[model samples]
Target: MDLESFLLGAVYYYGLFIGLSNFEFDWNTGRVFTSKRSTLYAIGTDSCISVLYIYYWTGNANIVDAIFGKANLLHEYIVVIMTGLRITTGLFTLIHRWYQRCKMMDLTAKVVRMYMARPQVKRMSRWGILIKFISGSVTDGLQMAIILNTMGRVEPQFFLGLGLQYWISVILNMAMVQQYMIMLFVRTQFQLLNSELRQVMEETKEVQLNRRHQGVFMTRCCSLADQLEDIARIQDELQTIVNQLEKVFAIRAAMIYGGYYLSSVGTSYLAYSILKHGYENMNMTLSTVILVFCWCFFYYLDGLLNLYGMLHVQDDYREMMQILGERTLFVGLDVRLDEAFENLNLQLIRNPLEIKVVELYDVTRRSTLAMIGNLITHSIFLIQYDMEHF
Candidate 1:
């Protein structure tokens, strides 16, 4: 009814909209990683805080009415119910996040197993898993703290302070996550190059065994080595991107936390000023309404700022995933069969010079034909094999 209460309601509903919108957008975009569960917790806690504000204001109104003999119990009861719902919502969010974390861990384990099969690229996979675990744990801890504080009836100032701390922690953790991902990508590139190098070395061994093949083998090895070197160069560029991300996160964290503290202090001072000077003209209802609006406005601003940070973090994560997805090698049957046949031919060709060239050629041609037929048959076998495994 008053302007302040109306604004408080607007702020609360607006925050609800923003929070829900973010949840829906992230879910659709597939950016909901393990850390996102914590975000849902945060949104729930914020909604609870808003409800608490409403309850506090409504109670204050009832107290004023009792003293002045003006009835406002209906409003007070409505707000109390809202408070209860908010608390329940917060509890549900906590449980949801806990369940999601467990599921995420299970998925992560599966991913690690898949990565280990890479053998050459296992180190990068391990690093990625480690970083994700650390980041997820820290985020979940922070969210838990917020849930406890809300349920335990913490003072508003202390709650805001803790929220700011969590924000800083989240930003830093995200930065570390990004850095780890870049390192993982670098490691993957190295693994690929290492595998290429091993192949080149095997070719070099063939050249060593037969001095006549030295020039051709050396040229191919050199070309492959050059490609590996180029990959290294690209990794260096990726490292530079990681460095830039670190700097951006550091600066952004400082600004965000700094702004949060400054805003809190400013809001507190503003409330104090209004309470001290406006008492003569303002009724208790008006004062309570003003306080509610102030709290809600501060929360709204904090949510917006956090949303910005999350968007940045999510953008980087999506970019990294996109890159990784693109790099996934699609080992076609044709390619694999060609490689297998080539290896087989190379091994068979290393025979004694007493073998006639014509006989060797005939053997090579026949072997090639046999290999082609076998590959087609085996390709069909693999389809059945995969179906059975699935």
Candidate 2:
């Protein structure tokens, strides 16, 4: 019911862990306050980890030596590209979150106020959060085991690279999950708005039906109009929330999607090369295969969930529009009702709700399918090249 009640579920801990946010929240006052100590810690930790990751990889010439005897150009390049993506994304998340910390705090305050205003809305589900946390932990553990088994004795550089890679990966993954969860929260708000509108519509129809037998017909109509206006205002606020969150996440969303594509292609190619070369150490080969497969599985699921969350918000918007259209038809010939219906329709039309990635392109079903198609096509090309070459 309150911000603190749900913050523990996912946002707060992940933010603290990944340096996404370092602000303290006052639940009673719905205030988000930041301290110099927390800010310095977030900045220092993120910067040090990033510098260490870069330093470790830059001088290390044996990156692929653990997996391949001779350097496979493609595999090495893929590692470089993937590492670059991870670092770029990790740094961007940290920097951008800091740059937008004030705006984010304001948005958090808005969300808290919205929730306070509507206690009927469902609180964040700790069960879902627990399941996700457990799943991620298990996946990370499996990845570490597989990598250690394949690479054998973890040299300092190898350990450093692997540890840093895991750090960046965790940061990006947590950011992705947080964005998805916030969008889900917004979708729920839209849903609640639609439900309230439906109730008002039903009540209006009942009042109309009893108009002949009742004396407070005009009074009831006026009350319904007030309810409609209140719902409109809520919808407007929800839209603002969506837009503000978009600013917070647009670039990161694009980077995350791009990271997924690169990961899938790189992993697919690695699997092909491993198969072709047929490493003499059977255990190493098997471990490498499992490691690649596990990474692919987690990335695939992460991308799917993000895409679904975006699409679901779009679906809710469409449903809200449909309900508004229905209400328009039943508004009769009253000038006030007509204006209200027209204004709501026009507002939706002019400023439609859209979840965008990269700040320019809207994430729709068609676009998402196309993205998947492109990923598959690229993976196939890379796999074919690996077969013919390495």
User: Which candidate number maximizes TM-score?
Assistant: 2
lDDT (Cα, tens digit) per residue for candidate 2, span 311-362: 8878989998888777644644345655666788888999999878767777
Error of 1 at 15 (Å): 18
131-188 in candidate 1: lDDT tens per residue? Answer: 3444444444545444343424444444443343344334333333433443354446
At residue 83, candidate 1 shows an lDDT of: 36
Candidate 2 ranges with C-alpha deviation above 4 Å: 1-10, 124-139, 143-151, 213-215, 279-285, 331-335
Clash counts per candidate, in order, are: 0, 0
**TM-score against truth, every candidate:** 0.31, 0.88
Candidate number achieving the greatest lDDT relative to the actual structure:
2
* lDDT, residue 284, candidate 2: 47
